[model samples]
Target: MQGFSGRFKDLVRRLGVTLFGIFELLGLPRVPEKKDGEGRGKG
Candidate 1:
């Protein structure tokens, strides 16, 4: 039904936002395996 689909879409959007925020907080923008001589130092 239309209502069910709408709810599902909203739920998925919320979950994506939450996961993205968690990643952002956990240093998602920084590369983990990069070394000092490359560019960015290790976190």
Candidate 2:
């Protein structure tokens, strides 16, 4: 039998892929990651 952790991981991976597909269908752009001290009052 398969392990519970393996099943959980598969579920999470599938969910992430589905969400990404929806985003692509809607033509949404991914948010850019924040750089080091970029928004930490370090101008």
Candidate 3:
């Protein structure tokens, strides 16, 4: 059986990383831009 602490920690870390990638793909408001403000590119 796996140790509880290690398994739990890994799960939390994986979850955090997964959530970050998901939000990045979603392009949420809180994410920072390389420029000073929002992108004004042609859509």
RMSD value for candidate 3: 6.5
TM-score of each: 0.61, 0.62, 0.59
Candidate 3, residues 1-43: lDDT per residue as tens digits? 7799989999999999999899888886574657765667687
lDDT of 2 at 18: 100
lDDT of 1 by residue, 1-43 (tens): 5698899999999999999999999987886776668875488
Q: Give the TM-score of candidate 2.
A: 0.62
> In candidate 2, how many Å is residue 29 off?
2.0
C-alpha lDDT score of every prediction, in listed order:
0.87, 0.89, 0.84
Question: How well does candidate 3 score on lDDT at residue 2?
Answer: 71
True lDDT of residue 32, candidate 3: 64
| Span of ten consecutive residues with least summed lDDT in model 3 | 29-38
Q: Give the Cα-based TM-score of candidate 3 against the true structure.
A: 0.59
- The top-ranked prediction according to lDDT is 2
The candidate, 1 or 3, that scores higher on lDDT is 1
* Model 2: pairs clashing at backbone N, Cα or C within 3 Å: none
Residue 34 local lDDT, model 1:
64
Ranking by TM-score: 2, 1, 3
